[model samples]
Target: MSPRLVLVGPPGAGKSSVGRRLARHLGVELRDTDADIERTAGKSITDIFIDDGEPAFRELERAAVAAALAEHEGVLALGGGAVGHAETRAALRGHTVVFLDVGLADAVGRVGLNRDRPLLLDSPRAQLKRLLDERRPLYEEVASVTVVTTGRSIDEVVQEVILHV
Candidate 1:
């Protein structure tokens, strides 16, 4: 069986949170590629990035996403930069992909310049803006539905996703 819903978006877009709720609401398991990566590497994403670099982390990420997409029959949440890879986007072709869009303001609050988030370690606001600029189009391209998560609560976002998914 294939995933019933796949969530793709930038960090702080609430993919994991909404995914858990949506999965529970739908009575399905929630498979997060990031968590999968951490489990596989036996380290946090930041540690992987710092110890192994982004290229290495991305390779792991791509593999995890591919495996989850092929094997899971539930709600799947991809890492923020997963769609940056062409193969990941292509792999999403026949799946119900949802893009959770969040503005910089909300994103900064949700995803601060925390040590855990390697990408956002330097100037979170600016970095987030750049990330959004580079990745928004890609997210839109693969998304069957785009849910703006700015100012919306988790429940509200879940409702919107439920309506679309």
Candidate 2:
């Protein structure tokens, strides 16, 4: 079992939204690793971060990604930082990974002071920018195709992704 499509991007890059629509369009289920981690851990991601710290959360995320990649024959959406793990990046080989590229302005606008995002607790704009900058290469490295979601509608992005798949 494996994903028909895998979406990767920073927060506010529309991974969840696009993943849902894409999966529906493709007549498949959407499995988000973040959601998976939360389900398995029986806690929210923010709480996991607070209680277990980033490293622990990342470990859970890695395992979740591996499980989803191996077991889910549907659409999969990964947390923004999942690409930071070298093992995850290597594991992405031969998968149909899409990088949902979003600009800082669009990202900030979408995420805007959202407290639930554990990484964006301080100066969301700056933090988002840094995340985008730091993770763009990793996203690119793992992606088979890239879709810019900066000003595009979900439909538009989904259509483009469909073309790639």
Candidate 3:
């Protein structure tokens, strides 16, 4: 069977970091939609949003996410906002999705205020809280398994994800 897994969470929940390690442990390719979009656009996500606006960037992200699902069999780390797309969320149903849950403090610590993350443009603590509040329900609704990621080593999280997968 195809080893298809999706990692869902807000920024700084270690989706990309854990994803690479998980893919390594699982012996599958790691396909990160953010990286894919960056490569496709020939620019960073921040640049995409600045030049083309958020709606345009979302369009690009949606397309890249769908393409990754179609073309790859590996751990897929989506951008923090990718789950906001109803169609993409629908497509994720019945697949193995693990929500790497992180509180505002942890997320803020993991990602400083001056990062390239578009959504994290404001005060990181408040912004992270807002984002977590906004995306929390959506993540839970779509996830087959939820893993609390704060204070845990990457190996621990990877083990949990492997268990769920």
Predicted model with the maximum TM-score: 2
lDDT by residue (tens digit), candidate 3, 1-165: 333799999998999899999999988888889999999999999999989999999999899878877788888999999998998898887788999999777888899875699877867788889889998999998999999999998999999888887
Could you tell me the lDDT of residue 17 within candidate 1? 96
For all candidates, what are the clash counts? 0, 0, 0
Among these predictions, the greatest lDDT belongs to: 2
- Measured against the true structure, the TM-scores of the candidates, in listed sequence, are 0.98, 0.99, 0.96
User: Which prediction has more favorable TM-score, 1 or 3?
Assistant: 1
Model 1 over residues 26-107: C-alpha lDDT tens digits? 9999999999999999999999999999999999999999999989999999999999999999999999999999998999
Q: Relative to the true structure, how large is the alpha-carbon lDDT of every model?
A: 0.95, 0.96, 0.89
Candidate 2 — which residues are off by over 4 angstroms?
Answer: none
Better of 2 and 3 by TM-score: 2
Task: Estimate the TM-score for candidate 1.
Answer: 0.98
